[model samples]
Target: MILETSVVPRDSAEPCADRLVLGEHVLGVADGATKKPWDTGPDGAELAEAVAGHLAATAAGCPAREAVDGATALVRGLLGDAGVGSAVSFCVLHLGRREIWRVGEGRVLLDGLPVPPRPSGERIVAEARALVLRRHLADDVPEATLRADDPGRAAVQELLRALVGLRNRPDPRYGYGALDGQDVPDLFVEVVPVPGGVREVVITTDGYPEPAPTLAEAERLLAQRLARDPLMLDPPETKGKRPAANSFDDRAYLRVAL
Candidate 1:
């Protein structure tokens, strides 16, 4: 049974780049990567919606690898290589198997214990960006400046560019995976067991670094964090909330009680 669900865009004026699917014997949340306004590619929202649809139609007994492959092939067929770096991260719960399949970066908790994310240089990368944010804050930059026009992004432009290039690459160390119309290495796909006696499962996008079991607590924590660090640089590794935005990134949540 589902206890709660939410899919909200960071900027209400724009389309949400995240998706939630409550499917037969399957539940999922897909967080789409946001692109620069000038970038030319399929919109993240469109890709996420397509993925959600694919997963919903997928048979419950399908293997994890097969599901990922089919999704990848679907995207590749539609967009070809042009959308190589445009990607979406997903977390799915298969009730039939009592398992969870995840790809790319997001947050998931079974009974409040985190399922470790696939390894990457995420920590160091976030630290680098956070350092830039600190420098800007020291200069007395306004919150609006940080939100509307993040000048610090230029400082980490090279790193961000490299991250995009590494998407769906095969290299185990520095490479990562996403539903980006590229071949995803097995190392990047994860299968987590939903063991017995797990009373609750909470899944969310990276927008919420910490996943709370209930929607109320989660919202309270989010509000507290936004007040404390609107730029999302305190702990690092997140895109900052835009001016007039509720959160730094698109957020989706799904909670189930077994």
Candidate 2:
């Protein structure tokens, strides 16, 4: 049974980089990294759609490895040997194996418990941003002004870009995962078998700081966060508040019943 699913662009002006795919025997969520101005190839939204299409096309009983291999090849084909093919993070469910294959930092919950991954270096950068955000706010900077033009951006953009080099490095300090049509070390891909007792699974993008059990609840939690700390200065600190969007990041949530 399907509970709910949605993918919305941050603002009406831009395309959403997140995607949700439901295949015959599998379904998953894909989140393409936001593109930067220096980015030269197809936008992350297009890449995400391509990857999502590949995921939804997989035949029933296809091995999770083969599915990912195909997606990786597609990404490489699209971006070629570019210096950085910003990739997509995903969480896929293989009904045949009763397994969930997750790459990167997308969130997942079985029953009501979280299936957490190791911390990445994103926090370091998020804190840097929060520091700037708070300082500006203390100086009476309007929240709307911060959203329109992030004064804190220049101070931390370089630090944020540096994290790109750490992708998939397997380093405890900075390594994170993604599917960019390259060889993602096994260390970054997590294949989890759904226990027999587990009856439901929730998969979501990091847009929601804390994923709730239901879509209504998820939206509620997101609204609560946006109202209380739009800057995301608490735990899962992000780059900044919504740049001109409904939420800070594009989001997708999928709940399934076995």
**Best of the candidates, lDDT:** 1
Model 1 Cα shift for residue 71 (angstroms): 0.6
| Per-residue alpha-carbon lDDT of candidate 2 for residues 155-178, written as tens digits (9 for 90 to 100) | 677776777677767787688777
Q: Which ten residues in a row have the lowest lDDT in candidate 2?
A: 235-244
Predicted candidate 1 versus true structure: per-residue lDDT over 1-258, tens digit per residue: 998999878889999989997788789798888875444567788888999889877796798899899888877766667445467788899888888889987788899888878877655667787888888879898777877887666577777777777777777777778888887789888899899989889888887777788878888898899888888887885478777888888889999987
Residue 165 lDDT in model 1? 79
Q: Give the Å error, residue 213, model 2.
A: 1.3
134 in model 1: Cα distance from truth in Å?
1.2
Query: Cα miss at 166, model 2 (Å)?
Result: 1.4
Candidate 1 lDDT:
0.81
